[model samples]
Target: METNEILRNQIFEIIKNQLKHNNPPETKITLDRLRAQGFNDSQARQMIGQCISVEIYQIMKTNEPYNNARYIENLQKLPKEPFE
Candidate 1:
Protein backbone atom coordinates (compact mmCIF):
# COMPACT_ATOMS: atom_id res chain seq x y z
CA MET A 1 0.00 0.00 0.00
CA GLU A 2 1.05 3.59 -0.49
CA THR A 3 2.29 5.45 2.56
CA ASN A 4 -0.82 7.59 3.02
CA GLU A 5 -3.08 4.59 2.53
CA ILE A 6 -1.02 2.67 5.06
CA LEU A 7 -1.36 5.44 7.59
CA ARG A 8 -5.12 5.68 6.97
CA ASN A 9 -5.52 1.98 7.50
CA GLN A 10 -3.49 2.18 10.68
CA ILE A 11 -5.72 4.97 11.91
CA PHE A 12 -8.78 2.97 10.92
CA GLU A 13 -7.52 0.01 12.89
CA ILE A 14 -6.92 2.21 15.91
CA ILE A 15 -10.50 3.48 15.63
CA LYS A 16 -11.87 -0.05 15.37
CA ASN A 17 -9.85 -1.08 18.39
CA GLN A 18 -11.02 1.94 20.36
CA LEU A 19 -14.64 1.07 19.61
CA LYS A 20 -14.04 -2.58 20.33
CA HIS A 21 -12.41 -1.92 23.71
CA ASN A 22 -14.05 1.40 24.54
CA ASN A 23 -10.76 2.37 26.20
CA PRO A 24 -11.69 6.01 26.49
CA PRO A 25 -15.45 5.37 26.25
CA GLU A 26 -15.50 8.92 24.98
CA THR A 27 -14.70 7.61 21.53
CA LYS A 28 -17.86 5.53 21.35
CA ILE A 29 -19.83 8.36 22.93
CA THR A 30 -18.49 10.77 20.37
CA LEU A 31 -19.45 8.37 17.60
CA ASP A 32 -23.00 8.21 18.91
CA ARG A 33 -23.22 11.97 19.34
CA LEU A 34 -22.08 12.58 15.78
CA ARG A 35 -24.57 10.05 14.48
CA ALA A 36 -27.38 11.70 16.41
CA GLN A 37 -26.36 15.01 14.90
CA GLY A 38 -26.86 13.50 11.42
CA PHE A 39 -23.37 12.32 10.55
CA ASN A 40 -23.22 8.88 9.00
CA ASP A 41 -20.91 6.23 10.44
CA SER A 42 -18.15 6.89 7.92
CA GLN A 43 -18.32 10.64 8.34
CA ALA A 44 -18.34 10.43 12.13
CA ARG A 45 -15.47 7.99 12.20
CA GLN A 46 -13.50 10.22 9.82
CA MET A 47 -14.08 13.13 12.19
CA ILE A 48 -12.92 11.01 15.12
CA GLY A 49 -9.90 10.04 13.06
CA GLN A 50 -9.08 13.71 12.61
CA CYS A 51 -9.01 14.07 16.40
CA ILE A 52 -6.67 11.12 16.57
CA SER A 53 -4.47 12.77 13.93
CA VAL A 54 -4.33 15.92 16.03
CA GLU A 55 -3.29 13.92 19.06
CA ILE A 56 -0.68 12.11 17.02
CA TYR A 57 0.66 15.39 15.65
CA GLN A 58 0.95 16.85 19.13
CA ILE A 59 2.73 13.77 20.38
CA MET A 60 5.22 13.83 17.52
CA LYS A 61 5.73 17.60 17.53
CA THR A 62 6.03 18.07 21.28
CA ASN A 63 7.31 14.62 22.19
CA GLU A 64 4.62 14.44 24.85
CA PRO A 65 2.50 11.46 25.76
CA TYR A 66 -1.06 11.10 24.45
CA ASN A 67 -3.47 13.53 26.04
CA ASN A 68 -6.89 11.98 26.54
CA ALA A 69 -8.32 15.25 27.83
CA ARG A 70 -7.41 17.10 24.65
CA TYR A 71 -8.68 14.24 22.52
CA ILE A 72 -12.00 14.24 24.33
CA GLU A 73 -12.26 18.00 24.08
CA ASN A 74 -11.65 17.79 20.35
CA LEU A 75 -14.31 15.10 20.02
CA GLN A 76 -16.81 17.26 21.89
CA LYS A 77 -16.28 19.97 19.32
CA LEU A 78 -17.07 17.72 16.36
CA PRO A 79 -17.94 19.06 12.85
CA LYS A 80 -16.49 22.29 14.18
CA GLU A 81 -13.16 20.62 13.45
CA PRO A 82 -10.25 19.76 15.79
CA PHE A 83 -7.29 22.15 15.85
CA GLU A 84 -5.26 20.82 18.81
Candidate 2:
Protein backbone atom coordinates (compact mmCIF):
# COMPACT_ATOMS: atom_id res chain seq x y z
CA MET A 1 0.00 0.00 0.00
CA GLU A 2 1.01 3.61 -0.47
CA THR A 3 2.47 5.39 2.56
CA ASN A 4 -0.57 7.58 2.96
CA GLU A 5 -2.89 4.60 2.77
CA ILE A 6 -0.78 2.83 5.39
CA LEU A 7 -0.99 5.83 7.67
CA ARG A 8 -4.74 6.06 7.23
CA ASN A 9 -5.14 2.41 8.08
CA GLN A 10 -2.87 2.81 11.07
CA ILE A 11 -4.96 5.69 12.33
CA PHE A 12 -8.10 3.63 11.83
CA GLU A 13 -6.58 0.78 13.83
CA ILE A 14 -5.52 3.06 16.63
CA ILE A 15 -9.03 4.52 16.78
CA LYS A 16 -10.45 1.02 16.73
CA ASN A 17 -8.22 -0.11 19.56
CA GLN A 18 -9.17 2.89 21.66
CA LEU A 19 -12.83 1.96 21.35
CA LYS A 20 -12.28 -1.70 22.17
CA HIS A 21 -13.67 -1.61 25.71
CA ASN A 22 -16.48 0.80 24.98
CA ASN A 23 -18.43 -0.20 21.86
CA PRO A 24 -17.66 -2.00 18.65
CA PRO A 25 -15.02 -0.13 16.67
CA GLU A 26 -17.42 0.19 13.79
CA THR A 27 -19.86 2.02 16.07
CA LYS A 28 -17.40 4.57 17.35
CA ILE A 29 -17.27 8.15 16.12
CA THR A 30 -14.73 8.41 13.33
CA LEU A 31 -13.22 10.78 10.78
CA ASP A 32 -16.54 10.67 8.95
CA ARG A 33 -18.24 11.84 12.12
CA LEU A 34 -15.66 14.60 12.51
CA ARG A 35 -16.47 15.71 8.97
CA ALA A 36 -20.12 15.82 9.94
CA GLN A 37 -19.02 18.06 12.78
CA GLY A 38 -17.78 20.60 10.13
CA PHE A 39 -14.12 19.58 9.73
CA ASN A 40 -12.99 18.94 6.16
CA ASP A 41 -11.98 15.41 5.12
CA SER A 42 -8.26 15.79 5.82
CA GLN A 43 -8.89 17.80 8.95
CA ALA A 44 -11.29 15.17 10.18
CA ARG A 45 -8.86 12.35 9.65
CA GLN A 46 -5.94 14.26 11.13
CA MET A 47 -8.10 15.18 14.09
CA ILE A 48 -9.10 11.58 14.52
CA GLY A 49 -5.48 10.52 14.96
CA GLN A 50 -4.76 13.56 17.09
CA CYS A 51 -7.67 12.70 19.33
CA ILE A 52 -6.40 9.19 19.81
CA SER A 53 -2.89 10.46 20.43
CA VAL A 54 -4.26 12.85 23.03
CA GLU A 55 -6.10 10.04 24.76
CA ILE A 56 -3.04 7.86 24.78
CA TYR A 57 -0.83 10.69 25.92
CA GLN A 58 -3.17 11.36 28.81
CA ILE A 59 -3.40 7.71 29.72
CA MET A 60 0.34 7.18 29.68
CA LYS A 61 0.89 10.25 31.81
CA THR A 62 -2.23 9.89 33.97
CA ASN A 63 -6.03 9.65 33.62
CA GLU A 64 -6.48 13.13 32.21
CA PRO A 65 -9.86 14.39 31.00
CA TYR A 66 -10.46 14.24 27.28
CA ASN A 67 -12.79 17.21 27.12
CA ASN A 68 -13.59 19.54 24.25
CA ALA A 69 -11.07 22.13 25.35
CA ARG A 70 -8.31 19.56 25.49
CA TYR A 71 -9.30 18.21 22.11
CA ILE A 72 -9.29 21.66 20.59
CA GLU A 73 -5.83 22.26 21.98
CA ASN A 74 -4.57 19.11 20.35
CA LEU A 75 -6.29 20.02 17.10
CA GLN A 76 -4.50 23.34 17.07
CA LYS A 77 -1.17 21.57 17.17
CA LEU A 78 -1.89 19.82 13.88
CA PRO A 79 -0.17 21.19 10.79
CA LYS A 80 -2.14 23.66 8.69
CA GLU A 81 -1.40 21.32 5.81
CA PRO A 82 -3.00 17.95 6.54
CA PHE A 83 -0.83 14.87 7.22
CA GLU A 84 2.46 16.47 6.37
Candidate 3:
Protein backbone atom coordinates (compact mmCIF):
# COMPACT_ATOMS: atom_id res chain seq x y z
CA MET A 1 0.00 0.00 0.00
CA GLU A 2 1.05 3.59 -0.50
CA THR A 3 2.64 5.38 2.43
CA ASN A 4 0.00 8.09 2.64
CA GLU A 5 -2.78 5.55 2.79
CA ILE A 6 -0.92 3.61 5.44
CA LEU A 7 -0.46 6.72 7.51
CA ARG A 8 -4.11 7.62 7.13
CA ASN A 9 -5.12 4.20 8.37
CA GLN A 10 -2.88 4.50 11.39
CA ILE A 11 -4.28 7.92 12.17
CA PHE A 12 -7.79 6.62 11.75
CA GLU A 13 -7.00 3.80 14.11
CA ILE A 14 -6.05 6.27 16.77
CA ILE A 15 -9.28 8.14 16.14
CA LYS A 16 -11.16 4.89 16.37
CA ASN A 17 -9.57 4.16 19.71
CA GLN A 18 -10.52 7.57 21.04
CA LEU A 19 -14.05 7.17 19.87
CA LYS A 20 -14.33 3.66 21.23
CA HIS A 21 -13.07 4.43 24.70
CA ASN A 22 -14.55 7.91 24.90
CA ASN A 23 -11.43 8.98 26.69
CA PRO A 24 -11.29 12.77 26.98
CA PRO A 25 -14.91 12.78 25.69
CA GLU A 26 -14.19 15.60 23.24
CA THR A 27 -13.37 13.25 20.42
CA LYS A 28 -16.88 11.84 20.28
CA ILE A 29 -18.33 15.27 20.87
CA THR A 30 -16.42 16.59 17.87
CA LEU A 31 -17.51 13.64 15.81
CA ASP A 32 -21.16 14.19 16.71
CA ARG A 33 -20.86 17.92 16.11
CA LEU A 34 -19.43 17.39 12.68
CA ARG A 35 -22.15 14.90 11.85
CA ALA A 36 -24.74 17.44 12.98
CA GLN A 37 -23.22 19.88 10.51
CA GLY A 38 -23.91 17.43 7.66
CA PHE A 39 -20.60 15.60 7.55
CA ASN A 40 -20.84 11.84 7.19
CA ASP A 41 -19.20 9.51 9.70
CA SER A 42 -16.05 8.92 7.66
CA GLN A 43 -15.79 12.62 6.85
CA ALA A 44 -16.13 13.60 10.50
CA ARG A 45 -13.48 11.09 11.53
CA GLN A 46 -11.18 12.37 8.80
CA MET A 47 -11.59 15.87 10.16
CA ILE A 48 -10.78 14.61 13.65
CA GLY A 49 -7.90 12.69 12.17
CA GLN A 50 -6.50 15.97 10.91
CA CYS A 51 -6.35 17.20 14.47
CA ILE A 52 -4.53 14.02 15.43
CA SER A 53 -2.06 14.53 12.59
CA VAL A 54 -1.29 18.07 13.68
CA GLU A 55 -0.65 16.95 17.25
CA ILE A 56 1.51 14.11 16.01
CA TYR A 57 3.49 16.49 13.84
CA GLN A 58 4.08 18.88 16.70
CA ILE A 59 5.07 16.09 19.07
CA MET A 60 7.58 14.70 16.61
CA LYS A 61 8.90 18.14 15.67
CA THR A 62 9.31 19.41 19.21
CA ASN A 63 9.71 16.17 21.16
CA GLU A 64 7.00 17.50 23.43
CA PRO A 65 4.53 15.36 25.23
CA TYR A 66 1.05 15.16 23.77
CA ASN A 67 -0.86 18.41 24.13
CA ASN A 68 -4.40 17.66 25.21
CA ALA A 69 -5.38 21.31 25.14
CA ARG A 70 -4.31 21.77 21.57
CA TYR A 71 -5.91 18.49 20.61
CA ILE A 72 -9.23 19.46 22.16
CA GLU A 73 -9.01 22.98 20.76
CA ASN A 74 -8.39 21.72 17.28
CA LEU A 75 -11.27 19.31 17.69
CA GLN A 76 -13.60 22.06 18.77
CA LYS A 77 -12.62 24.06 15.73
CA LEU A 78 -13.68 21.18 13.49
CA PRO A 79 -14.09 21.52 9.69
CA LYS A 80 -11.99 24.68 10.06
CA GLU A 81 -8.71 23.03 9.02
CA PRO A 82 -6.51 22.55 12.05
CA PHE A 83 -3.10 24.04 12.96
CA GLU A 84 -4.15 27.48 11.80
Candidate 4:
Protein backbone atom coordinates (compact mmCIF):
# COMPACT_ATOMS: atom_id res chain seq x y z
CA MET A 1 0.00 0.00 0.00
CA GLU A 2 1.01 3.61 -0.43
CA THR A 3 2.64 5.42 2.48
CA ASN A 4 -0.34 7.61 3.17
CA GLU A 5 -2.67 4.62 3.09
CA ILE A 6 -0.42 2.76 5.48
CA LEU A 7 -0.38 5.68 7.84
CA ARG A 8 -4.15 5.97 7.70
CA ASN A 9 -4.55 2.28 8.47
CA GLN A 10 -2.17 2.55 11.39
CA ILE A 11 -4.12 5.47 12.78
CA PHE A 12 -7.37 3.54 12.41
CA GLU A 13 -5.90 0.56 14.22
CA ILE A 14 -4.71 2.79 17.05
CA ILE A 15 -8.15 4.32 17.39
CA LYS A 16 -9.81 0.90 17.29
CA ASN A 17 -7.52 -0.44 19.97
CA GLN A 18 -8.20 2.54 22.19
CA LEU A 19 -11.95 2.08 21.79
CA LYS A 20 -11.71 -1.68 22.32
CA HIS A 21 -10.45 -1.06 25.83
CA ASN A 22 -13.83 0.43 26.78
CA ASN A 23 -12.58 3.99 26.75
CA PRO A 24 -15.41 6.51 26.55
CA PRO A 25 -16.11 7.54 22.97
CA GLU A 26 -14.97 11.03 23.81
CA THR A 27 -11.64 9.99 25.21
CA LYS A 28 -8.79 11.67 23.39
CA ILE A 29 -5.53 9.91 22.66
CA THR A 30 -2.40 11.71 23.68
CA LEU A 31 0.53 12.42 21.38
CA ASP A 32 2.95 10.84 23.83
CA ARG A 33 1.08 7.56 23.66
CA LEU A 34 1.26 7.45 19.89
CA ARG A 35 4.90 8.43 19.91
CA ALA A 36 5.69 5.69 22.39
CA GLN A 37 4.01 3.31 19.99
CA GLY A 38 6.68 4.28 17.37
CA PHE A 39 5.00 7.02 15.41
CA ASN A 40 7.01 10.15 14.76
CA ASP A 41 5.87 13.45 16.20
CA SER A 42 4.08 14.67 13.09
CA GLN A 43 2.44 11.31 12.45
CA ALA A 44 1.28 11.06 16.04
CA ARG A 45 -0.21 14.53 15.94
CA GLN A 46 -1.96 13.83 12.66
CA MET A 47 -3.40 10.58 13.96
CA ILE A 48 -4.79 12.21 17.08
CA GLY A 49 -6.34 14.98 15.00
CA GLN A 50 -7.90 12.44 12.66
CA CYS A 51 -9.33 10.51 15.58
CA ILE A 52 -10.99 13.67 16.82
CA SER A 53 -12.42 14.35 13.39
CA VAL A 54 -13.84 10.84 13.13
CA GLU A 55 -15.45 11.08 16.55
CA ILE A 56 -17.07 14.38 15.65
CA TYR A 57 -18.35 12.92 12.41
CA GLN A 58 -19.82 9.92 14.21
CA ILE A 59 -21.63 12.10 16.70
CA MET A 60 -23.10 14.18 13.90
CA LYS A 61 -24.15 11.38 11.54
CA THR A 62 -25.71 9.11 14.15
CA ASN A 63 -28.55 9.28 16.66
CA GLU A 64 -26.06 9.75 19.48
CA PRO A 65 -26.71 12.72 21.69
CA TYR A 66 -24.39 15.60 21.00
CA ASN A 67 -21.75 16.22 23.63
CA ASN A 68 -21.13 19.92 23.73
CA ALA A 69 -17.83 19.73 25.55
CA ARG A 70 -16.44 16.95 23.42
CA TYR A 71 -17.63 18.64 20.24
CA ILE A 72 -15.96 21.89 21.17
CA GLU A 73 -12.77 20.20 22.26
CA ASN A 74 -12.52 18.13 19.11
CA LEU A 75 -13.22 21.11 16.93
CA GLN A 76 -10.55 23.06 18.70
CA LYS A 77 -8.08 20.28 18.23
CA LEU A 78 -8.86 19.65 14.58
CA PRO A 79 -6.18 20.69 12.10
CA LYS A 80 -6.92 23.92 10.30
CA GLU A 81 -6.95 22.11 6.96
CA PRO A 82 -8.14 18.61 7.74
CA PHE A 83 -8.21 17.54 4.09
CA GLU A 84 -4.62 18.54 3.45
Candidate 5:
Protein backbone atom coordinates (compact mmCIF):
# COMPACT_ATOMS: atom_id res chain seq x y z
CA MET A 1 0.00 0.00 0.00
CA GLU A 2 2.77 2.39 0.89
CA THR A 3 4.61 1.64 -2.33
CA ASN A 4 1.48 2.12 -4.36
CA GLU A 5 0.85 5.50 -2.74
CA ILE A 6 4.40 6.59 -3.43
CA LEU A 7 4.22 5.58 -7.07
CA ARG A 8 0.91 7.33 -7.50
CA ASN A 9 2.37 10.50 -6.06
CA GLN A 10 5.32 10.31 -8.40
CA ILE A 11 3.08 9.75 -11.41
CA PHE A 12 0.90 12.68 -10.39
CA GLU A 13 3.90 14.95 -10.02
CA ILE A 14 5.29 14.01 -13.41
CA ILE A 15 1.99 14.64 -15.09
CA LYS A 16 1.60 17.95 -13.31
CA ASN A 17 5.05 19.08 -14.30
CA GLN A 18 4.46 18.20 -17.93
CA LEU A 19 1.23 20.14 -17.94
CA LYS A 20 2.87 23.12 -16.33
CA HIS A 21 5.56 23.26 -19.00
CA ASN A 22 3.25 22.98 -21.98
CA ASN A 23 2.57 26.24 -23.81
CA PRO A 24 -1.18 25.68 -23.56
CA PRO A 25 -1.22 22.89 -20.97
CA GLU A 26 -2.24 20.03 -23.23
CA THR A 27 -5.55 18.37 -22.53
CA LYS A 28 -4.08 14.94 -23.17
CA ILE A 29 -0.95 13.16 -22.02
CA THR A 30 0.54 10.42 -24.14
CA LEU A 31 1.01 6.88 -22.87
CA ASP A 32 4.44 6.92 -24.50
CA ARG A 33 5.52 9.70 -22.19
CA LEU A 34 4.25 7.84 -19.12
CA ARG A 35 5.92 4.66 -20.27
CA ALA A 36 9.16 6.52 -20.81
CA GLN A 37 8.75 7.68 -17.25
CA GLY A 38 8.63 3.99 -16.21
CA PHE A 39 4.93 3.37 -15.79
CA ASN A 40 3.21 0.23 -17.06
CA ASP A 41 -0.05 0.42 -19.02
CA SER A 42 -2.33 0.09 -16.01
CA GLN A 43 -0.28 2.53 -14.02
CA ALA A 44 -0.30 4.97 -16.86
CA ARG A 45 -4.05 4.78 -17.17
CA GLN A 46 -4.54 5.32 -13.45
CA MET A 47 -2.22 8.29 -13.53
CA ILE A 48 -4.05 9.79 -16.47
CA GLY A 49 -7.35 9.44 -14.70
CA GLN A 50 -5.94 11.07 -11.60
CA CYS A 51 -4.55 13.89 -13.71
CA ILE A 52 -7.92 14.48 -15.33
CA SER A 53 -9.65 14.51 -11.96
CA VAL A 54 -7.20 17.03 -10.62
CA GLU A 55 -7.62 19.25 -13.69
CA ILE A 56 -11.39 19.11 -13.32
CA TYR A 57 -11.12 20.14 -9.71
CA GLN A 58 -8.82 23.01 -10.57
CA ILE A 59 -11.14 24.21 -13.33
CA MET A 60 -14.09 24.11 -10.95
CA LYS A 61 -12.24 26.20 -8.44
CA THR A 62 -10.76 28.75 -10.80
CA ASN A 63 -13.51 29.33 -13.36
CA GLU A 64 -15.82 32.17 -12.44
CA PRO A 65 -19.64 32.11 -12.52
CA TYR A 66 -19.54 28.37 -12.33
CA ASN A 67 -22.12 26.55 -14.37
CA ASN A 68 -22.94 22.92 -13.79
CA ALA A 69 -23.43 22.29 -17.49
CA ARG A 70 -20.11 23.85 -18.39
CA TYR A 71 -18.36 21.91 -15.66
CA ILE A 72 -19.66 18.61 -16.96
CA GLU A 73 -18.80 19.60 -20.50
CA ASN A 74 -15.27 20.48 -19.53
CA LEU A 75 -14.90 17.18 -17.70
CA GLN A 76 -16.00 15.34 -20.81
CA LYS A 77 -13.18 17.04 -22.67
CA LEU A 78 -10.52 15.55 -20.40
CA PRO A 79 -8.26 12.89 -21.86
CA LYS A 80 -9.09 9.23 -21.37
CA GLU A 81 -6.71 6.28 -21.30
CA PRO A 82 -6.13 4.04 -24.35
CA PHE A 83 -7.13 7.02 -26.49
CA GLU A 84 -4.87 9.72 -25.15
Candidate 6:
Protein backbone atom coordinates (compact mmCIF):
# COMPACT_ATOMS: atom_id res chain seq x y z
CA MET A 1 0.00 0.00 0.00
CA GLU A 2 0.97 3.63 -0.41
CA THR A 3 2.21 5.80 2.44
CA ASN A 4 -1.14 7.52 2.80
CA GLU A 5 -2.95 4.21 2.98
CA ILE A 6 -0.44 3.00 5.52
CA LEU A 7 -0.94 6.07 7.66
CA ARG A 8 -4.69 5.82 7.45
CA ASN A 9 -4.57 2.15 8.38
CA GLN A 10 -2.20 2.85 11.23
CA ILE A 11 -4.49 5.54 12.56
CA PHE A 12 -7.41 3.17 12.21
CA GLU A 13 -5.59 0.55 14.27
CA ILE A 14 -4.80 3.07 16.98
CA ILE A 15 -8.45 4.00 17.28
CA LYS A 16 -9.49 0.36 17.31
CA ASN A 17 -7.00 -0.35 20.08
CA GLN A 18 -8.06 2.74 21.98
CA LEU A 19 -11.74 1.87 21.79
CA LYS A 20 -11.25 -1.76 22.64
CA HIS A 21 -13.50 -2.82 25.52
CA ASN A 22 -15.12 0.59 25.47
CA ASN A 23 -18.32 2.16 24.29
CA PRO A 24 -18.50 4.11 21.06
CA PRO A 25 -18.72 7.84 21.43
CA GLU A 26 -20.70 10.38 19.46
CA THR A 27 -19.28 11.45 16.12
CA LYS A 28 -19.34 15.11 17.05
CA ILE A 29 -17.72 14.23 20.34
CA THR A 30 -14.89 12.39 18.60
CA LEU A 31 -14.41 15.22 16.13
CA ASP A 32 -14.40 17.74 18.92
CA ARG A 33 -11.75 15.77 20.71
CA LEU A 34 -9.56 15.66 17.62
CA ARG A 35 -9.98 19.37 17.04
CA ALA A 36 -9.19 20.12 20.65
CA GLN A 37 -6.03 18.14 20.14
CA GLY A 38 -5.05 20.52 17.29
CA PHE A 39 -6.23 18.62 14.25
CA ASN A 40 -7.84 20.57 11.41
CA ASP A 41 -11.24 19.64 10.03
CA SER A 42 -9.77 17.42 7.35
CA GLN A 43 -7.56 15.65 9.79
CA ALA A 44 -10.41 15.36 12.20
CA ARG A 45 -12.53 13.70 9.54
CA GLN A 46 -9.76 11.28 8.66
CA MET A 47 -9.33 10.38 12.29
CA ILE A 48 -13.02 9.73 12.60
CA GLY A 49 -12.93 7.35 9.66
CA GLN A 50 -9.99 5.65 11.28
CA CYS A 51 -12.04 5.30 14.39
CA ILE A 52 -14.87 3.67 12.44
CA SER A 53 -12.49 1.18 10.88
CA VAL A 54 -11.19 0.43 14.34
CA GLU A 55 -14.71 -0.04 15.64
CA ILE A 56 -15.58 -2.45 12.85
CA TYR A 57 -12.45 -4.48 13.43
CA GLN A 58 -13.14 -4.57 17.12
CA ILE A 59 -16.68 -5.82 16.58
CA MET A 60 -15.44 -8.58 14.28
CA LYS A 61 -12.59 -9.58 16.59
CA THR A 62 -14.69 -9.70 19.74
CA ASN A 63 -17.97 -10.72 18.13
CA GLU A 64 -19.69 -8.02 20.14
CA PRO A 65 -22.19 -5.51 18.91
CA TYR A 66 -20.74 -2.06 18.34
CA ASN A 67 -22.45 1.31 18.29
CA ASN A 68 -24.08 1.87 14.95
CA ALA A 69 -24.73 5.59 15.26
CA ARG A 70 -21.12 6.45 15.95
CA TYR A 71 -19.94 4.10 13.23
CA ILE A 72 -22.25 5.73 10.72
CA GLU A 73 -21.16 9.14 11.80
CA ASN A 74 -17.52 8.22 11.42
CA LEU A 75 -18.19 6.62 8.09
CA GLN A 76 -19.64 9.90 6.89
CA LYS A 77 -16.34 11.59 7.59
CA LEU A 78 -14.16 9.11 5.75
CA PRO A 79 -12.57 10.34 2.55
CA LYS A 80 -12.07 8.18 -0.52
CA GLU A 81 -8.88 6.81 1.03
CA PRO A 82 -5.34 7.05 -0.45
CA PHE A 83 -5.23 10.58 0.89
CA GLU A 84 -3.79 12.78 -1.81
Write down the TM-score of every candidate: 0.96, 0.38, 0.95, 0.38, 0.36, 0.41
> For candidate 6, what is the lDDT?
0.62
Question: What does candidate 4's lDDT look like per residue over 1-53, in tens digits?
Answer: 89978756775665566557735444344555556668687775565657455
Each prediction's whole-model lDDT (CA) = 0.94, 0.57, 0.92, 0.56, 0.52, 0.62
Give one clash count per candidate, in the order shown.
Answer: 0, 0, 0, 0, 0, 0
Measured by lDDT, the strongest candidate is 1
* lDDT over C-alpha atoms for residue 63 of model 1: 100
Mind sharing the TM-score for model 4?
Answer: 0.38
- Name the runs in model 1 displaced over 4 angstroms: none
Kindly list the per-residue Cα lDDT of model 1 for residues 1-84, writing each as its tens digit.
899999888898999999999988999999999999999999999999999999999999999999999999998999889998
Model 1, TM vs. native:
0.96
Q: lDDT: which is higher, 2 or 3?
A: 3
Across 7-65, the per-residue lDDT of candidate 5 in tens digits comes to 66775665566557752233234555656668786776565656545545566777744
Q: How well is each residue in 1-84 modelled by candidate 3, as lDDT tens digits? A: 999999999999998899889987999999989999999999999899999999999999999999999999999998999983
Which residue pairs show collisions in model 1? none
- Those runs of model 4 whose alpha carbons end farther than 4 Å from true positions after fitting are 1-29, 66-84
Candidate 4 achieves a global lDDT of: 0.56
How good is model 5 by TM-score?
A: 0.36
lDDT of 1: 0.94
In candidate 4, position 34 carries an lDDT of: 53
lDDT of each residue in 12-77, candidate 6, tens digit only: 665555456344445556656767778897787665766566676778887988867656555455
- Find the candidate with the highest TM-score and give its number: 1
